[model samples]
Target: MNAPVRRRRRRLPLNVLLGLGLATIVVAVAVLAPVIAPFDPMRMAAGPRLAAPSLAHLFGTDEFGRDLFSRVVRGAHLSLGIGLAAVVAGLAVGGLIGLVAAFAGRLVEAVLLRVIDLLYSFPDTLIALALVAFLGPGLVNATIAIAVSLVPFYARVAYSLAVAERAKPYVEAARLAGIGSGRLVRVHVMPNIGQSLIVMATLGFSSAILSAAGLSFLGLGVQPPSPEWGAILASGRNYITKAPWILIFPGLAICMTVLAFNLLGDSLRDLADPRRTAPQRAGA
Candidate 1:
C-alpha cells in the first residue's frame, strides 16, 4: 500500500523519469529556439531544394528548400507554448467556476451544470473552429479558442470531485467547526480535488496542442512564416509523393509528442486517484 510513495521517494519507474526528461528537453528547445536553431527557420535556401538528409541539412530540405530540421525544432516552441498556455487558462477558469458551483448550493449548481451540459453538447472541435473564425487568425486568439473548448471538461471533473469530497465526514466535521463556506472550500475541497484537476489539465494540454496544430495546418493558427509544426506539414504536404520526409517528420513529431503526453497523464491519473486502485492496492 505504501510502496508507491516509497518508490517515488527513493526511485521510480525509469519510463516515468525518462518521459519527464524528454518533455523537459523538448520544452527547453522550444524556449531557446532562436539561440539553438542552426539556420533561419523561416528563410528558404535556394541552394538546397529538395535535398535528402545529410550532415549539412539534417532532416532534409522541404519543397521550398527550407531547413526541415530547424523549422521542426522551432515549431516545437509554438505547439508546446500554445498548449501549456491554453491548458493553464482552461484550468484556472474552469476549476474556479466548478468549485463555486459545487460549493454554492442546489440553485447555483443546477444552473452551472446546465451551462456545462450545453457546452458539452457541442463538439470541442466545433467550438475551436468557431472561435478562430470569429476571433480571426492569430496565436493568442487560437490559444483562447482551444482553451475555451477545454473548459467544460475540467469543470465537470472538478464539480464531480467536489460533490464527493463535500459528502465526506471530514468535510462535514469542518463545516461543524464553524468554518465559513469560502474558507472551508479553499482549505478543504480545493486541496482534495487538486489532483483531479491536474490530471484533467494534462489531458487538456495534449488536446489543445493537437487542435492548435490542426488549426495551423488549415492556415488559421500562428500564421505563415512562424514555423509551427502544423505549418511545416502544410508547406510540405504537396510534396508527399517526392519528398515524404518533409511531411512525415513533422507529422511524426506531432503524433508522438501528443501520444507521450497522453500516456503520462494516464499514469499520473492512476497514481493520484486511490479509488482507481482499490482492488489492486487492497489485494497487494
Candidate 2:
C-alpha cells in the first residue's frame, strides 16, 4: 500500500469513526430541526398528554402533550451550541493566557498560575452555579459561567505544553535568530501543541455540555419554554412515574452526545500521542 493511503487509514481509529458518525447525525438533526420536526416543539394539545411512543409521536407526548421527539430534536441545538461556544471561548482566552504565562517572567507566571489554581480549586459545577447566581439565570449567563469555569483547565494544559515546547532546540534556534517573542510563540509553539489542544477541546466540549445541562436542570441555565434538554429533563422529573418516556428520551440524548464526544477525544488523544500505538506497530 502507498504511504499516503496507509497514513490515511491509520489516521482515524474505529472509535473516532463511530463518534464522528454519531456526532454528525446529531448535528444534522439539530440543523434540520425546523424542517424535520413534525410538530411545533412548544405547542400543546389536549388529546395526547402523556401518550406512549406511537406513529403520531415517535418518542411519545409529554405531560403538556408536546411532541417529545420534536422537543428532543430542538433541544439538540441548544445543547450542542453551548458546548461548541464555550469550548471556543476557553480555547481563545485560556490559550492566550497560558502562552503568555509560559513565556513571561517569573512574577507574571506566578500570578497567572496562582489565579488559575484558585479557579481550579473549586468544583466546576459550583463555580458555574456561583457565576450564574451572580449574573442571574439565563442561557447566555450559563454559557459564560461554563466557559469561565473551563478556563483554568485549558490554561493549565496549555501552560504545561508550552513550557515543555519552549525548551526544545528549535525554539532556542528561533529565539537566537532574533525572531520576535510573539511570532516565535505563535509560529513555533502553537503548531506543535495544536494537536494536544484539539484533543483537550474535544474532551472539554463534553464537560461544557454537561455543565450547561446541570445548570439548566437546576433552573439556573436555559429557562422554561426553551426546549433545552436539561430544562426538558427537569420538567419531566415531576412526572417520572406517570410519564417515563418524557424523561427517557431527553436523558438518552444527553448520554449519547456526551459519549460520542468522549470517544472522539480518546481517539484523538491516542492519535496525537503515537507512543500509545508504538508497541503494536513495532510488533507488526
The lDDT leader among the candidates is 2
For candidate 2, list the clashing residue pairs, or say none.
none
lDDT of 1 by residue, 120-238 (tens): 77777778899999999999999999889877877777787888888899988988999988998888888887877787676677788888888988988889888888888887888
Candidate 2 RMSD to the correct structure = 5.6
Task: Give the Cα error of residue 133 in candidate 1, in Å.
Answer: 0.9
Question: Which parts of model 1 are misplaced by more than 4 Å?
Answer: 1-15, 277-284
Candidate 1: lDDT over CA atoms? 0.79
Clashes of 1: 0
The TM-score, computed over Cα atoms with residue i paired to residue i, of candidate 1 is: 0.88
Which window of 10 residues has the lowest lDDT sum in candidate 1? 275-284
What local distance difference test score does each model get? 0.79, 0.85
For every model shown, what is its TM-score relative to the native structure? 0.88, 0.91
Best by TM-score: 2
